[model samples]
Target: MSTLTTAPDPTSETAQLVRRARRHRSRRALRRTSALGLLLAAAVVVRVTLGDYTVTIPDTLRIIGGADIPGASFILMESTLPRAVAAVLAGASLAVAGGVMQDLMRNPLASPDILGISGGASTAAVFSLIVLGLSGPGVTMVAFLGALAVAAVLVGMSSGGAKGGTHALIIVGVGCSALLVALTHWVLLRADVYRLSEAMVWLTGSVAAASWTEIARLAVLAAVALPAMLLLHRQLRVMMLGDDLAAGLGVAVERHRALAMLGVVLLVAGTCAVCGPIAFVALLAGPIGRRLHRGRTRLVDIALIGALMVVVADYIGAYLVPGGGNLPVGVVTGLAGAPFLLWLIVTRTRVET
Candidate 1:
């Protein structure tokens, strides 16, 4: 008689399946992140090398190496190079902020510009420029404080609500944003023609005039914030499963969320103060990164995707348009981002209904 074969344990079979799925996701993430990194490098090279005034790659390298290569030297060093670098920094900053907030809130719709954090910063910066006659660092400081205040209010309100999560934050944030926008309009209305013109340029979100000093400041902000964001990824993923589950797993959900929220504010405010509010980089970057990775996304992946979008858009705005007039990088992103936002709203509605 044949001995009866023991059956396979269901639990063991299930564990194997889980392990297999996880490995698949890990491999996908690695492939996608590598591809995005390559794309970003290529975008930077193209922006530097193939402009209205094309410079050879060898000459571009020489310029970076501190060679005085005539017309190429001044244009590449003073303007085009700086603009591309700033776009990368600012776009990466916006994306990380968005990725953190979206992950924390479990909502793709929770970006700074959409929720009015940028508007609050803009309102304060405009006030400083017009009423207080502040310039440079003063405006940046005011914008930072304003973003912090708005974010603090949002957290307080959301936590105070009965449900106290995505819906509450979105509702309170939209209301605050409207109020901030109105205040900005009021400030602009009161300013003289010269100040009004200056405020308008900034409000449009153009980095056409980005300076080396501003880029340096933004780069430092990124250095501090990007690592902090990556460090929180594990905590954020835990919370995404549910607050109760996260708490049970030994994660301090509320405290971590607040700290993460503060980081978002720092990133948005710094970018606003330096590059103006480049619309939709934050809103668009994380979702795209998640799709690309086909798994839980890395903050760096999201950041590189954002940098690519902005650098490419900035290049198009500066050089690709039929009209000689340069489009503001903000305008290009807004045109592209607004449609995506509408699509998200529609898609989300269908899913909810």
Candidate 2:
């Protein structure tokens, strides 16, 4: 019997590509979920066995799961859980923001804080505290808007240039960041002693005052923003291929960039609102995540890896020191990221030449 040959359907080809992308995402999700699980376990182990004073892992887990202990559960829920949640949310949010910035700006060094985005937020929040005497949700709202404003300015400036030169953007962003940071410092210096003390955690990127209020707010914002990023996954990937190419493929390049910038602002602002603009997670996460996943995973994967890193690092900070009180998670990440950043610059220059 003779068998007739059939032509492949064009829609089927497109559907296949879509299916492959979904499969890739699913695999990445599995890997990240597994990594996060391990991180949680490790965090618990580190917190219990070696932190402050030694407690058994089982006891720690019980404390975490809310079996009331005498004054222990109170401490864990009030202090430890908040800090842990802050670490995870800050890590994931900043990393995703950085990944988006890097892709949008076409610069490996691009980050949310790099473009004065977080600096703007920090500056605004500081102004609110010192000048307007604002607090609570008002401060957060102002910071969020400030971040968006900086992003808008950057996009406008970049659009004016004939070529979206990455170096030019970097230089401009650095200048803006420095100026805003200087202003923030000036404001802090002029403020009252108590206010300065209060702002110290923010200025230094500390999670020292992590609380349930901060956790709940950031968690909701992150939940919304993460899904938004996921929905734009394909658009972001296209944008990474360059604006001209994306435009040629019928993608509204400028519009997409604008949306992406909004995503970055939301991600970074929500994080800064809670964790006080923790440094380097935005700068380091994308590159580190790319390296960890062998450059195979998408931005979402990078975000998950970042979350795991922060959670793990926060656990170390919480438990590694001799005293019950620990350094801020931001301090630890900043220390770690600085050296890696230097290495990246050196390696990148060498490779280019």
Candidate 3:
């Protein structure tokens, strides 16, 4: 018995390699995640402390630590800090929303903006501002409702099963985007000049007026929506291997997919409502995250990259732009993202879906 030997399973080598590859990918994602987090932290610090007013690091820390140091406190806690925090939360929400959209549509170019989710929110937000004379949370609530309505329409129209559903969804999304754009323009055309300027600026997106109350509310939204998306990640990954295979593996593909979409819609609406639809944070973050992770998207990486992107963009818009007036963060993101979008279209010959 002692002298008898057993052979390893025939598939052991392949299984081991697969496991090793997975581990490598996980480690790589972890590295990038950490780097992204650090970068985001640095960005937040810079945004909070190094603006034109230039709050010293110690005073900034004290301000964060709840010191009421007169003018410094007002600048730090009321203005800079809230704006920075809002940008981070909004960015993370948009990025995670993008990742979910890509998974659902199976298209790398898919995002809240492209699918008209942002358009819906923007339309409602502008209407509430100019037509209804609503401001603050009222506009945000309208935007969220508008986003949900658009997402529901999309899900309803695109549930034609897997074969042609994706294509139909893409077509419908583009149409929705165009229709929404026309509607937005029509609404704007009817606006008074004074309100039109306000609407235009809001549509361009700015975090400068971010209030602590708004930040608190967005933080709560993030706490719920982000976790929900992350919880569905493994399920979504399994579902990627064809519907039949996913069903065989015991995933309720339709249910989970719908759930994921709900989460995505919530996230997109929350961010758009809070800051208007800051363009391209959702579009760019997922692909960059996937490239860094060397494969499928990691929600954390996507979130971190997105947060950093918006924070940096906001910083530029807020302080670094040539004009003394604060530039809208949306404008900055549009400027940075347009070239990248062109590059993506030219380079990516075949989109998976």
Question: In candidate 3, what are the lDDT values of residues 1-353, reduced to their tens digit?
Answer: 37978898869988999999989877877777788889899999999998778899999888888888888888888788888999999999999999888877777777889889999989988888888999778887898888888888777764546446666776787899999899999999989999988778878877877777878888999999899899998898987776678889999978887898888878887787778889999999999988886667789889998999999999998889986588899999999999998888777755533
lDDT of 1 at 146: 91
lDDT of each: 0.87, 0.78, 0.85
lDDT of predicted model 2 = 0.78
RMSD per model, one decimal: 2.4, 3.9, 2.4
Task: Give lDDT for model 3.
Answer: 0.85
Instruction: Look at candidate 1 and tell me the lDDT of residue 77.
Output: 90
Off by over 4 Å in 2: 1-33, 48-50, 53-66, 160-164, 321-325
Instruction: Return the clash pairs for model 2, or none.
Output: none
Per-residue lDDT over 1-353 for candidate 1, one digit per residue giving the tens place of the 0 to 100 score: 89999998999999999999999878877887898889999999998888778889899999999899889998899878998899999899999999888887788999888788888888988999999999778988999999999988877765523265687788878898899989999999999999999888888887777789888888998999888988987798998898788889999878887888888998999899887888999999989888776546688899998899999999888888788588889989998999999998999899999
Q: Residues 1-353, candidate 2: write the lDDT tens digits.
A: 99999898999999999999989977876777677567655764554355454556677688867687776666666666566667777888898899888877877787877779999999998898888899778888989998988898888876734254888888888888999988998898888988988888676676658678878888899999988987776787887777777888998887777888899999988888777888788888788767766664367667766777787767766666457466677777888888988998899899999
RMSD of 3: 2.4
TM-score of candidate 3 against the unseen true structure = 0.92
Candidate 1: which stretches are off by over 4 Å?
A: 1-21, 160-164
